[model samples]
Target: MALDKLIGLAMLAVASAVFTYYTIWVFVLPFVDESNILNSFFLPRDYAIKLPFLLLLIAGLGVGTFIGNVLIKKAEKEKLKKSKKSD
Candidate 1:
């Protein structure tokens, strides 16, 4: 569908923009003068590394929680089935 294509394109564009900005902030900015006005546009250099690390940590936790929940539910369902068979 056209709508789906549009959404995908928009997401790709946004992702590309973020990647370019982050690359610049991390790799290029450090070499730039600290007193330059460009430095003010970005957060302190330390956060550029910390932010992505924090995001990855949170995403990992979320995935782990989701998998645990699904496994727990599946085990409960199997246990219930077994109990019903014995009844």
Candidate 2:
């Protein structure tokens, strides 16, 4: 259980870091230039994917993944408690 928690925390930290980087890059890319190298991220392309209203979708995905993992762990812990109680 301790190991699982540690791994989950580590993964969440990494994902958060990646999310921050992408968020900042996307925000600053346009200021750089219309044909700037950073423009290759195709962030604008994503805007028109007709998915969401903001460009934070990538970071949102990271957050969602982290939350899902955490919920799964919590459910596993609950199941363990139930099993022990049954015993």
Candidate 3:
């Protein structure tokens, strides 16, 4: 619901989609001829592979930072709550 969560989810969705597409392109498309229409949907074979890898790396970093931020916020909130309780 929050913007942070929405952004995180979007990043995750994009990563998943890219990974799925790349998997199919690399593993399944090999069986299809280069002349097939399906081949046009993807980049040249090498770039296709490299691009997805890069996207995944970026998405992974985003997700990791998001989770870290959420954890840190939670910890900060708990610390504040405890300090108030003791005051």
Candidate 4:
């Protein structure tokens, strides 16, 4: 649908903007003078590194939890099936 396409395009645009901002903050700002106005637009330099690492760590934990939950549910289902067969 046209609405879906519009939403997707909007999301893509936002993602692109964030990526460009992050890339500039990480790669370009470091070399810029401390007194420059650009520094005001972003967080401290350390966060550029720490933020991604923290995000990655959180993402890993989320994925691990999801996988574990799925495995637990699967084992429970199998156990139930075996018990039903034994009955």
Candidates sorted on lDDT, descending: 4, 1, 3, 2
Clashing pairs in 2: none
Model 2: lDDT of residue 11 = 100
Query: Candidate 1 residues 1-87, lDDT tens each?
Result: 699999999999999999999999989998999999999889898898799999999999999999999999999999999999999
Off by over 4 Å in 1: none
RMSD of each: 1.4, 8.8, 6.7, 1.6
For model 2, what is the C-alpha lDDT against the true structure?
0.76
Cα lDDT of candidate 4 equals 0.95
Pitting candidate 3 against candidate 4, the one with the higher TM-score is 4
Task: Give the Å shift of residue 20 in candidate 1.
Answer: 0.5
Give the Cα error of residue 25 in candidate 3, in Å: 5.7
TM-score of 1: 0.87
Candidate 2, residues 1-87: lDDT per residue as tens digits?
Answer: 699999999999999997776666656654786777767755564554354455477779889999999999999999999999999
Evaluated at residue 37, the lDDT of candidate 3 is: 96
Candidate 3 least-lDDT 10 residues: 43-52
Query: What C-alpha root-mean-square deviation, in Å, does candidate 2 show against the real structure?
Result: 8.8
